[model samples]
Target: MEARSRCRLPCSYYMTCKCCMKRMDGKGKSFIRRTLGSTGFVQAVGTKAGPNGTTLVSTGLSDLDKIIGGGIPLGGIIMIMEDIEAPHHLLLLRYFLAQGVVHGQPLLFASPLTSPKSFLGTLPGLTKGKDSKGNVDLQKSGQSADGLRIAWQYQRYLNEQKALETRRQRQQEIASQSWASGRLHASSLSPNLSSSVTSGSLEYTGTFDLRKSMDQAMLNAVNTVCFSLQGETDMAPLHGQCAAFVTTHSRSVQEVPNVGRIAMQSIYAPQSMHLFSEWKMLSFLAWLKGIIRTANVVGLVTFPASLLKPSVLVRLQHLADILLSVEAVSDDHKEMEAMLTDYQDISGLLHVHKLASINTQVPSFPEASTYSIKVSRRKEVVLEHLHLAPVDVYGKGSGNAGAAQVLCSTPANAPSSLDF
Candidate 1:
């Protein structure tokens, strides 16, 4: 019995023998074992590695991207609560689709409008040779010729020259510091690093011109699919389309990963609201959230929050990875005019409700929850921090100040005024 017991292998020996061999092999023939290279994961255009190793795709608006903590992550859904009175949500949808088109990413756009394809024609074109502020350099455009011809422009020209000289000196100092820090030498060693930096600086997120439509040739080159939700009786067909689209661009099917964008405009618009039940709509969102969570796709859905019940709206908000709401500012509102310094420039207010917290526990909070959205030069959409107008002590121009004083002043008939 002792001999038989000794000949038999121990229970742990059988269980750990292969693991031990693997550990030994791992230590000795490390070179033989394959390790994922830098190029192992294909990076799609318009996408960047974000915090916590998450992949981020630009929201098309650079300011919006900054506000939302870099960009929207892959496999995430961005829900924008629409302003019922105005078509402000379309501005966001257009930019999102246009950016995808610019990056050569596949786009699936669905809208409740009768002819969704016609909406593509309204997409903003990429502005070439524009600075980060989406402004063309006046000097480069020969607009300085008028200044040269005028006698009064001499002082202005001298001031401009002084400013240019100061800028040049500052740039030279920065370059010298970079060289001194050995960063210039390190950057020179990696050709791709320099190339990527140049490309990123130039075209990381395209600045779009709202006045110009995308070139026909450029639009034709892109693979775009548009769907009209006008006749759809239920959400099943649309859900299927989304699923199929996601499946086509899924990581498992692609040899090289390519990002896909799905934009749905006015999901709960009155025109299509009758076609879908509240539960059905909720299910569709839930299903979409599930499918996109596994695939290399990002989705944007804009819906009229005013049309939906509070409970349903809350559920929708919870499902969204990022939630944003737009409120149109009334031009005639004296209070608003008095409150904002740039009242004429402001078109609407953008509220950041929830930011995407994918693959992480910590949530991203913007420096300010609200930003003023306005058109710059009537060409580009600009988002700026809301700046309050200076308070007028005399209450001459400030309507809000006058109203506040009137409210604070107690009436003679009031009990509080009579006693204290």
Candidate 2:
């Protein structure tokens, strides 16, 4: 009676005692049983399992990944609308390719240039330090000659420190909970998770230094296939090549799965536009999209939006799962200069038109749709929210000069610490 009340059953009689079986199984046993029959997902390097059974790969930029609701998912197409005057799209392409190289993933690079292989040489090398701060250089430490400048800069520094501390504490709490729950065990966890505890770690996405080129040895080790669309009169040959590449990386039960990245730079540029009609180009894109949809591959295509007609551009945008556009900021644009406080630091603007929504109905919306693209002193690309310049009572220029004068004229040397 005591054993029955405790719901303890012998192994031989386990089937007869439903209550005992349920008590012994626990939640972990149920999870294990559910997954036992299912074919496990590929847990490759530089990839993580996202919500809704989708796998995510980094876009080379950590901030960009966060903005796009965790990295780019496998089997999705990313389209970037190019700026007519600037090569900002190339920055995105370089970073995307560089990330694949770092992860040792197979790459298929197609470009309108005669020598697509040469573009690989210009890829930025990964930054040495593991710190994410390497991407943003804030001149916050040194005391400025101006009192107001010193106060304002230090205040910004304090705020950044607080943010970092809060983030660190949150990460620690998450790690503790994951460990306590035992939901992610060594045997159950994917190689992607076992290798890296947290997705935010440096192993997942690396910071790159734009000033330095990747090491020659590292570039030589990667399996890179480059195709030149400089003078190809027919889209058939390119389409065939892509088909073969996708076949090599297709998901299969027999073969060990690996991630593949396909990058097409300026696909509809002037050089290639003469060879194929708009219909042919659209057909090619549709075909490419179909092939990559099933395979464990992600494709990034950049085209000059200004050259295409509105109807054609709309069709192209609709084809992309993730759509982004870059706009160059003119140096002499007085109106923009007056509107943004950090006008001098702004190089361009990044607009996120769409985000990849795979295996789910709910669309992911970022906190901001537009972000300012800034190049740090170390040549690292950084994205930040645009801050409007402060307005005065008269609605003229920033009233910083008068405020600085008033603060500096105080009898006591500026209050030692910030209030907040």
Candidate 3:
């Protein structure tokens, strides 16, 4: 193992640099902030940008990305609290994991209800028979060798076998770079990106079966562990084990050859009451915040908010960098809401209770901006602005409309939508 150099002052800490022997002046400090912030600094700096410039990772849903101002920022801890039991909750979780798999981000599943392997089995395959985050080789028959020769068929078969073996070797190389999501290299197509396909823009997509084993190389690049609640109540050991798991993972990340460090997130969904206690759980979550900020890993957990005490929820809410809750709505309610607003096919209500650093103490993404989610066959999980689509048949009152000439109306080129 190579011995890592230890610096007296860590730029991230805003401390004096002992090696430099000179204080980083205001200009130097500003530059460091911009660099770190842009790379997903865990610290919140102001109301507009996250404490730091946020490194936006795709939520795997473009619409959702737009609503949240461009995907979940790396180093963020998002809690999905549910007021009521809802199927959308499960779907959302699937979308989150599926997105990670598609991007080839390493996933660490820590749930008693669903084992990582079993949950993956239920995931749909990539649409194009290939993993979006990685490539899948297609088999092709080798050309016939010397059709006149008796050994031609055998030679062709051997050639085909060699090709398959080579492909396997290549796949192994890809898998070894487990934490390298396509987001890093997907832009290699062109430098003028706006005119072309943005990774988030709708394009080719496919299903990925989580149940199947990932490439051995990819598997080696990450660490995945599951904590099966042994029905024991001692929280100390469980807490230590969980914390150790995260700590070790963070440390090992340094060994991988990655463009940027992959953000770490531990997904925990307690199946029953025996898994964890509120106090211990709170402590575990608190410890998580430090790891998230210092190590630059994100934390995602699904908790039954209603089932837990309000105090616990409040503390967790404050501790988490981001909070989200799914509001279950029936089909009839969906239609009712849709008729009143443009929320057609409303799956459920998604509440953005708190968004850290955006006003710090209050929700700031979109105030009073109703939000709803809907999914597509292509695994497009949309969390868009909810609108009411009123029915106005016979062209009586179309939503997309043009007002007739009014007494004080401005000319075509002038501003008319609103006036100062």
lDDT: which candidate is best?
Answer: 2
lDDT of 2 by residue, 1-420 (tens): 333443333332222233322333442354234543342234555666566667778899877888887788888899999998999999999999998876667899999988999999999987653343522333233224334554665777766866876675455444333432243342243334333333223245777889989766657766789999988888877888898889988887315466789999998898876878899899889989988988888899999999998999999999998999998988977656666789899898888888888778998866766788899985689988877676545766554443233112232345642211
Backbone atom clashes (below 3 Å) for every candidate: 0, 0, 21
RMSD of 3: 15.6
lDDT of each: 0.72, 0.73, 0.46
Cα distance off (Å), candidate 1, residue 100: 0.5
lDDT string for model 1 (106-142, tens) is 8899998899989999999877535323224544444
Q: List candidate 2 segments past 4 Å from native.
A: 1-41, 129-202, 391-393, 396-420
- Candidate 3 weakest ten by summed lDDT: 41-50
For model 1, state the Cα shift of residue 263 in Å. Answer: 0.4
TM-score of 3: 0.56
| Model 1 spans with C-alpha error above 4 angstroms | 1-42, 131-202, 393-420
Candidate 1: residue pairs that collide? none
